[model samples]
Target: MSDIPQERRVLTAIPGPKSVELQARRTAAVAAGVGSTLPVFTARAGGGIIEDVDGNRLIDFGSGIAVTSVGASAEAVVRRASAQLADFTHTCFMVTPYEGYVEVCERLAELTPGDHAKKSALFNSGAEAVENAVKIARAYTKRTAVVVFDHGYHGRTNLTMALTAKNMPYKQGFGPFAPEVYRVPVAYGYRWPTGPENAGAEASAQAIDEITKQIGAENVAAIIIEPVLGEGGFIEPAKGFLPAIARFAKDNGIVFVADEIQSGFCRTGQWFACEDEGIVPDLITTAKGIAGGLPLSAVTGRAEIMDAAHSGGLGGTYGGNPVACAGALGAIETMRELDLNARARRIEEVMKGRLEEMRAKLPNGAVIGDVRGRGAMIAIELVKPGTKDPDAAATAALAKACHAEGLLVLTCGTYGNVLRFLPPLVIGEDLLNEGLDILERAFATL
Candidate 1:
């Protein structure tokens, strides 16, 4: 068990005096663009709670943006990483390779979806892994066009910014983006004009038509998408959507890449969301929860496709840091030992049930435009009562209310109208319900 208590406790105001001082110092030192959901600073965190400088124990619903699935300081991860740290922090895998890096790649090969011969290369962040995936795909297919979907967010890098769809915060004033990256419509069930039943096939058909017509299928190198959209509001693409896209990619020799950065590991009640549909992609990019809060990412794919790049063609100085690799191994071990996949499903059952009940109790059900997502990765789209139009203000207000009461929540979406929930997998049932109770109170305030 963790030393930190699994309960919400507020001391002083959220930022308190100490945190206020630190925020002042941060303002002077940090750039303006760097923003935080809370003004308070984290002193320590473990299990389901984050203790701030004020000694305010906030329930962690954000999981540091889905980066710490096993908890912020999981015992196994801390133990393994500490041992590796004492021995050596970094020998630079490119200069002098290490067993830890090789072992992590081997694990990725085994864990990532697919039984085919596979290979993997590591990177320090999801964006880097994505950039490398595109590189490998182009090298293998000998083509340049890359297809991405509407409302998907890959990363902040120049190349990924082109792949992303949202404009205001992610893409405004950040162009000209990488070329030949085409955007297609994804299966958004709630907003589907023709209805959710037809969303899968119709969205896939529309995407395929756009790719084949605008960017010739033969010219396309890869079609990269998130099986469950992340920063684009936890939208699970409609059923049959992934399979149709995968079939098109296979037939046209275009590499299919699943960006499972946010939805991978046990966050989505599966090791990888792609497994839900059994749609194996030619390449998959992983990060976030892979290293138990450590910065590490990987591009795992078929042997032939991965090996397409020439020897010495792919690598980075800190691609697979030894300590990060140890942390990843520990995370995988913990997942198996605790069966986090099962825990995630239980969380889904409990939380979704409560959320649905909350919706039913509301005077006007349209306050929650949609409640969707799988397992621990759930979200609610807020809207004006009795209307489908987005209520971004209500979303912001609800998140603010949660934060004020020692419940840390996060908001996201293409239109800034989603309140995403990404609690650590190890959160206890009672604590989880208490957090939901706090959320219901926040909703009531709204």
Candidate 2:
């Protein structure tokens, strides 16, 4: 049980006075590139409530962008991390190998979807994990090209920016990205050119054809995709799409990499979303929910492929920091103890049911567009009232409305029309409902 109360309470305006002052300070101190969903500065957070500087307790539906699955201040995570911190903070794993790092790698080997002699290497962020995965794939396959899908967002680094599909915010001015990266259409059911029903087969065929034509399959090192698209609107690729791509990769000797950074660790009703399709990737990248809010990421894969790198080829100074590893161990324990996988499923049922009901009853159902995603990683795509055209304006308005009412919601999408919901798995049923109620009211206001 957390010390903070599990409820939403607004004592002042959204930003309040203290948060306004903090925002001013942040504006001067923080870089201009940095951004936040809500202007309210968080004082503390635990369970499903985020207490801001103004004493406003907001229902946290974003979960710090799906980074805190076991809640922000999970007891075990704090306890274990504190224990590790008291002993020693940094002895860089690359310099003096630590037990915590090895233990975390062991956990990754066991938890990631694979049974064939798995191994892992830890990194500091999702981008590092992804870049390392690419490196490993290239080393093993002795190939240069990597294939990514439409609307897929890998990371912000040069290589990952080349892999990502979105252009405005992620890759607007940043240029001269890494080379040998090819993009293909994803099975985005909502806007699939052919149609949603045919998206699975058509998109698969089209992607393969493009790869074969543009970049010879023989020269491709990897085909990486998010089983459930993250910043690309939480779009779960159409059924059979993953299996088809995985099969193609296996047949062509291309490393099939699952970028589970935002969808792994019980966020999508499974440890990894690839498990939903029973598709095992050669390499899987994970982060966000792994370390109970700590910055940690990993590339877990088959031992043979992982060992393709030279003895001293892969490593970083802060990869798998001791405290972060301890937090990850604690987070895994908390997940097992609480059975958060089942909890995530329950959240899905409750959220999907409520969202569906709301969609049916909302004055302009078409404006709500599509409601999709698995488990707690759900999203609703806003569209024009009478057409399938994206309604980014409505999406922004709705998110702002939610924020004003002390509910934290996030908007995403290549077109910026998705409202994503990612509440902590430990969120009380009442708080979940209350948050959804706020979202419904926000929709009504729109």
Candidate 3:
């Protein structure tokens, strides 16, 4: 583990001299479109703390956007990756097969939901895994139309961009997206007009109605959704919503894909978010928390659906890099040893309790319109004082306040009015509490 103390220590201002200088350098070298939430550069991180170049240690609530559930540089992951690096770097899996890749696929098969003889294929990132899943679905169903939800986020690839609903940032200038993609409503409980109790059935009915009237289920290749939406906000679909859509897909011969990229690997208390409602998707796309901090993603699903692709039809040069596979194995070892699934449930108890308390303490018509999500993937949606309209500016200001106070936070949602918390599952309770304190202080400022 990193030697940095498990406490928020600010030796200087949040973006001190060193970080400011790096920000200036980055401005010249990096593209403006490739934005960053914080300007400070990290020197080291571990156990819920990220030490910046200025030596200021801030409490990490983002976990590198859910990429480091086992800590930024976990011991097991580092050890395995180092050994693999020393042995041999790469001889692409396709050109020369390797055992590490096979082992990783085996693990994925065992880990992902379902017991009907599952199979898996590894990739370098979540987007690639999702793209490949789409290919397999289309091939198996012999259909072309793909259905997505209103606030769901898949990835940035051309195909995923079409799957994702956000346009301002992800799909603004990247037009001419892939064809045969359809968008429908999601049961975002808090935002539903007819209250959360009925949101599930209402949204499902509308979605099915739309599909039947327009795309028609017979032509739909797949129905993809995030059990807990990520960049579009930590929006958990209303209860019964996912199951209804899933049943519709199955009945219509449409492949059901759960984008578990952000909510998988114990982030949602369960192994995957879909398991919360006993949803057994035909294909599940995973990444982010899969290989510690390394680049790795997998598409795990039923053997028949996974094997639909022709032998030479799917793969990439660096899809299942040996080093990443080792890291994944090590990550799995750490998860098993630490019982991170239980840890995530504990996280929910602490975080949800604190956030709900905060919401209650605040007066009626406060900026926080809603507090929602599962496990560590929680969020607070900011809204106008008297109405349910999104308060994006207040959300940004609160996040900036948190950043300055040594509590690293992130904002999401289609309207950019959600403050999301994705702390590493291994984060200590004391430190997590302290970060929440700073968050409370930030909200007070708003």
Q: Top model by lDDT, which number?
A: 2
Question: Per-residue alpha-carbon lDDT of model 3 for 1-446, expressed as tens digits?
Answer: 56678988989988999999999999999989899999989999997999999999999999999989999889999999999999999999999988999998898888888888998888988999999999999999899999999998989999999999999899998899999999999998998999999999999999999999999889999999999989988888889999999999999999999999999999988889999999999999998999999999999999999999999798999989999999999999999999999999999899989988888896642777888888889899999987889999999998999999899999999999999999999999999999999988877767
* Total backbone clashes of candidate 1, pairs 3 or more residues apart or in separate chains: 0
lDDT tens per residue, model 1, 1-446: 35987878998887789999999999999999888989989989999999998899999999999998999999999999999999999999889999999999899889988899999999999999999999999999999999999989999999999999999888899799998899999999999999889999999999999998888999999999999999999999999999999999999999999999999999999999999999898999999999999999999999999999998889999999999999999999999999999999999999899999999997755699889999999999998887789999999998988888888999999989999999999998988999999999988877
TM-score for each of the candidates: 0.99, 0.99, 0.98
Candidate models: Cα lDDT each: 0.93, 0.94, 0.91
For residue 369, model 1's alpha carbon misses the true position, in angstroms, by 1.0
lDDT of 1: 0.93
Q: For candidate 3, which ten residues in a row score worst on lDDT?
A: 359-368
- Which of candidates 2 and 3 is the stronger one according to TM-score? 2
Better of 2 and 3 by lDDT: 2
Predicted structure 1, TM vs. truth: 0.99
Model 2, position 61, has a per-residue lDDT of 96
Ten residues in a row with the worst lDDT in model 2? 1-10
Residue range 274-344, candidate 2, lDDT tens digits: 99989989999999999999999999999999999998799999999999999999999999999999999
| TM-score of decoy 3 | 0.98
